[model samples]
Target: MGKGGSSKDTYNIAHQKGTPGAGGNRGDRLIKEMIHDPYKTRSKLPEPTVCPECQALFQQGRWAWAEVPPNANQELCPACQRIRDRAPAGFLMLSGAFFQEHREEIINLIRNKEKSEKAQHPLKRIMDIEEQEGETVVTFTEIHLPRGVGEALNRAYEGELDYQYTDETSILRVRWHR
Candidate 1:
């Protein structure tokens, strides 16, 4: 039990940090501003909008791979915008001797994973794949896809997998080496 309350009240106070009657001090009442993504729309975009670049249909409050309906408004989907800007929300890095040896297999696995994820989610996409001096860097439009790809690689190849998520920059970095 917390100070001056039953377990349920204590639970509520702990869980609802800034809510009313949470029994917190002034600092706890202050609502922190959400981490901002510059690409995210400030307001809900009009429904049934389609991206001109990739033809991704925005309908039913989400983006999907549906056929563009008649009289749909044209707008750039976030994934295409991110691709055009080359500003990836996620990065997957592959390195080490084993990775260099099995590069083609790894890349094929990544592409397959991306294809499956992109079929379901229009926003999750691979922006680019670049080979640096000693590492292969793959960038994604959305932050979660890289992590998923890294986990898939780890599962298939038994590599060393690590993830770093930066809240300030709103990016997820996934590294896999075997």
Candidate 2:
């Protein structure tokens, strides 16, 4: 309400001191850290690319189950690449007495979940399922699948579900017990 009746200068002067520059971060603000997945492609794959391993097609900026057109570009999709490297982005651990008694039923559920997820998302896949001494470990090619599977298990069977995610990478660990 002074000379020019403008508060812009006052606001600018107040905020100018600690404002981030062109680089964006001033090291003071709590910027949300980005989780990186090495298996993910930084850039878009060329349209019509086909994964040689799984025969998944990369079209319209996504991978999906589709027939390969003649002379389609051949490249390993991220999921197949992760499988080949034996590096999984998600892990689901199942344990407890209830799981032991219902092992077959639980395994079927897990497989069913994977099948449904894979039908929609070609990248989301189960890498491996291992039965250890007292627990079962299922690994996934992508992080989202494990979380989805764990939630499905929790919903269907009413078990204890927990999730662990890291700050540096796109990985998830899910634990389920009944």
Candidate 3:
């Protein structure tokens, strides 16, 4: 048996080896699943994330910046990373006869909505827009853009809107049709 203080220290060290963030913490994978609180602060990150691709600043746990930082580097923020990899966090598809007839208006509405959203939360971005034969697909860097668009369309045009979220990919799929 060791000294009382030494034995207590040993127990603490052994328990800490299995705690989260520890080198050997992988055994407790359950902790990663039930605590996906995105609103969590970024104070823990080594350095504030600044995406060189899009010049986004992750300040206060948000991707919003008035101007690029003097120390900005090419560190890809989560939004830019997803955009660069062509993996959107949210998807919106506009279809049906009404959409085809009013394509320009709908597109403009989406753009305007995005502009306002970006003004407040820079992380909300439209990754890409694809115009298909009878439908248009909009890829978003975050889930809120697609959700806002769907809500707007549903309220304004009384369109048939359906939204589904896939946890596997952490992406939201939204569909709107007249």
Which residue window of length 10 is worst by lDDT in model 3?
A: 34-43
Residue range 15-43, candidate 1, lDDT tens digits: 67455553444324556666878888777
- Tens digits of per-residue lDDT, candidate 3, 91-154, equal 9999999988898998999999999998887778898999866689999988989999889888
Q: After superposing candidate 1 on the true structure, give the runs of residues whose Cα lies further than 4 Å from its correct spot.
A: 1-32
Alpha-carbon runs more than 4 Å astray in model 3 = 1-43, 47-49, 72-74
TM-score of each: 0.82, 0.83, 0.70
lDDT of 1 at 49: 95
Worst 10 residues of 2 by lDDT: 21-30
Q: Write the per-residue lDDT of candidate 2 for residues 1-178, one digit (tens) a residue.
A: 8885468875564457577644664435556868688888898887899998889999988898998999798899999899899999999999998999999999999999899889989998999989877799999999889998888888889989999998687789999998
lDDT of 1: 0.88
| Residue 132 miss distance in model 3 (angstroms) | 3.8
For lDDT, the strongest prediction is 1
Give candidate 2's whole-model lDDT.
0.88
RMSD to truth, every model: 5.2, 4.3, 8.5
Query: What does candidate 2 score on TM?
Result: 0.83
